[model samples]
Target chain A: MIDFENVKLKIGDTEITIGAVLESNGSTSNLKTGAWRSMRPVTDLEKCISCGICWSLCPEGCIIKRKDGKFEADLDYCKGCGICANECPVKAITMVMEEK
Target chain B: MAIAGLPEEEYLSCGHRACAGCGAATAIRLITKAAGKNSILVESTGCIEVISTPYPETAWKLPWIHGAFENPSSIASGISAALKAKGIEDEINVVAFGGDGSTYDIGLGHISGAFERGDNFTYICYDNEAYMNTGIQRSGATPYGASTTTSPAGRESIGKVEWKKDIIHILAAHKSPYLASASIGYPTDAFKKIRKAIETKGPTFVNLFATCPTGWRSDPAKSIELAKLAVETGVVPLYEIINGKHVVGMPRDISKLKPVEEYLKVQGRYRHLFRPEKKEMEINFIQERVKENLALLLEYAETGH
Candidate 1:
């Protein structure tokens, strides 16, 4: 087995893999796509009815079920698509402009 | 409580580079959930492949392979053969997917060959209408009167002159054991059809209508609503062709269909048909065509052919 830690071999000033193959799966999660957001979805927990429609329809699969049995998006990966807000049957989620 | 009776496990992880509110991404999430953990995914060179696997990063949690745009089906066939050679063909499901550009145009031959050979795999075509990844170029699946970069609606032209290719009928003629048409608008139906397609043996195909907010110039959040409107207006009928028998799904009756204009007026691709002058003739033609298509499917359902 190849040591993933040393898989990248330095060549002068650049680094390259042995065969350019990625052994690690789901590594894209390291990328914080939430930075790409211009709008943020703020959910009202009182009106939110844990129906999971937001979770099911989210393209990023970033929506998580909270401890209170309500659902909200993990802002670390949410791109502020507003799909959850648009699809929320209870109108609990609202899209607000993100402050830089 | 329970996430609407759907699988809680997610195979397509977050933080991938897919566009915000991407219908294809939603479709992929639903598909991977239905395929479960004991499956391998094969993807063609399209939006999903580009976004999901960019260099050393990957969004797929399953064992996935990327093939050329025109040969994912061919690659799937080889994988099926290898699985059979290992005597574990029945233990794993092989799912190959592509965009409309790859499925309805570039990869049609490879898909046909695989189906003709009865390859044990599932081929899904997530059709976003045009080649959105390549800047909205017209493809075989580009609907009639829709403007695109290659088929622009100008003073001299009226968008794509040709009607969208009937890819479902083309695949159905191969006598595949299972074939279905679904849209992201109806998630439950799409999930059921995808599960059925994966469970069925031999070559199975599902044409999933995915919306492109960028290409169509529609509201990103309205992707699912637009998809639903497509079905409600009979623009995209959900149906199944099991062993050469056609079974129409939602919007089964012609009278139940909402006006085709309700679906068309939302997307910017069809905006030209209404602006400068109301292209009454074109709208009428489209409405008639939608009715005719639904009528044909209803007839096929009644005839069982």
Candidate 2:
């Protein structure tokens, strides 16, 4: 949320300024964390009650409520904590391993 | 770690680098939600601090400051004083937090000084028993019979031989208006206490029971379950000492409660205690101590002195 795009770090033997160091307050969204995830959450729309439990429980805020009253996970950010799958009351969500 | 409800807030966002199913991280999320955006979070150097804010990155949405292992209380008191001096004391909430190593051992003097001076702030200690951030070193708050790197259980020793330092009683003796021992197992209860502590004038404290899955040799998914078992077993009593009156928060029926072994069985640190080579005496001692601790808490709750 705060501007930290300018912060960078060059750790190796090359002249590269990797803006990996985030000295900003709440600058986590800049990081596309999908690649770090070993597994991901997939939703079964038919069984979803739109209870918003996963929406509330997602630590990553990757689960979004669609305009049509359905839910989808922004896999680009979801770390597959399995909290959504664990909290789903109607067995609507499942976590599957990410394919390389 | 599943369908268990967390408040609909994104203060501590993902990709901030905390171990999976970290109870301390969970406690941080809950605290931020309760404290809201218009607050100052002062954290001591520990697992939460190290994991949340690695160099340029930070997980906090609020204005947060990092302090040394023994000085969050000192810095928070100064901040609270400065806020009052600027005539906007009510506009900001000053909160300080750290692990049990910082609270029960290292920063106690500063904490006592702040409490004695009546600083306007809320101090929460997420007690994980050991110096987990530094690779499972024993601290004063570590339970007896729990093995650690420093207090390893072997041929000549039975892990940490000392009982947990009674933090609630120590803080209560300071005559702080609000004090409570919270567990991650019962999050609503923890939230209620944190809100109450924030609202209370002057200094307040809450010692939170946070489970360390790695240090405790526990299952990641069972973090909350182990925390709940702690309260249910009376190993960590839930009570708030307000104005010298000890009020019990959640009372378990001791008659129906499971044995202390139930708590130990889930943890790998206590693995030696359950060995088949006959370590019955240590188990019996730990069991007796757990019961004794519960009986003492019940006494405090009933007598209020």
Candidate 3:
């Protein structure tokens, strides 16, 4: 049997192990197992003018710069502020809101 | 003793001040109702504090404390910390409320710090766009091209040159226990979100869009109407950023939503945007931005979490 202590969050229908929980309430006097929201980036390459506006404005610095200078967001760390989409002059970078 | 819903008792008495059809007042009333009588209100120096309390008196029926313009979250954090230290954590729910100016502008760092520290409190930002308490000045949360006391419509410029700050996502990055966005137009959703914030263990931040008739130069009665328009027009999509995921609760048909012009024309702040003589490119630019936002939100909903 899988150890309950070792068990982590299972995501999607496949239940892919994304990341282990570093700290669970751990008998803390007041803390509890918290819930989190996942944010994904959706870029329409056709509409994208390669303006790099999204790259410059990302607060989390999750947007990745390629060898070709084409901008793409790092899905793992992107918090989905929608600033990239909001600041995009050509309206290319958009936030894909993931439901709980 | 219903934990799932707001209390029926009115904690914010309707006596002292607040302008005619103040959205901040509605936010105060709604928030107090959700938090119940066993709650302490931490207010910043803005429209809510200025209008509700005139030094000698207050309109609040529950326990309330006023803080500086940029330190309501910190003040609330202190209150929560004190409660924990005194071992009376369950006796009262601590809530810090502020206007867009205090929240998205001067108080962002404080709000972020409180969240990062995992302060046990419910933080609500009643966003009415501009700094209404300070003569309708432009705030960081103000939308692009909207006229304010500071960003006036002139031959040189349209209005505010910046876009609204998304504090919910910022708080989400802190990995706070709970985070969400709500609006006065969606009372049931707003009530649910705030109730969740109160019941949660760690820090909870909710960004509420409050319609300001005085600030935005709109009809007082159109507060709720404009509020609904904000959600529909994608100017402010209704969503929750819990933990780290972004979720838009209301994903109705975009075709049913009124045009950007319909929402813009009613508010005098955006009158310059609708000018017939303006270059077609600038107007088209605004239109494209709105459409792109709507499309992005809808697409996000499709790829289910």
Q: What's candidate 3's DockQ score?
A: 0.01
Query: What digit string (tens of lDDT, one per residue) describes model 3 on residues B115-151?
Result: 8899899999898998898789999888888998888
- Judged by whole-model lDDT over C-alpha atoms, candidate 2 comes out at 0.81
Ten residues in a row with the worst lDDT in model 2 chain B?
Answer: B1-10
How does residue B8 of candidate 1 score in lDDT? Answer: 89
How do all models score by TM-score? 0.96, 0.86, 0.71
How close to the true structure is residue B115 of candidate 2, measured as C-alpha lDDT? 98
Model 3 segments beyond 4 Å from truth?
Answer: A1-100, B1-6, B276-280, B298-305
TM-score of candidate 2 against the unseen true structure: 0.86
lDDT of 2 by residue, B34-89 (tens): 78777988989899888777665676778888889999999999999999999999
> Which window of ten consecutive residues has the lowest lDDT sum in model 3 chain B?
B1-10
**DockQ list for all candidates:** 0.79, 0.31, 0.01
Interface CA RMSD of each prediction in angstroms: 0.8, 3.6, 18.6
* Off by more than 4 A, model 2: A1-23, A32-95, B1-7, B276-278
Count of backbone collisions in candidate 1: 0
Ranking by TM-score: 1, 2, 3
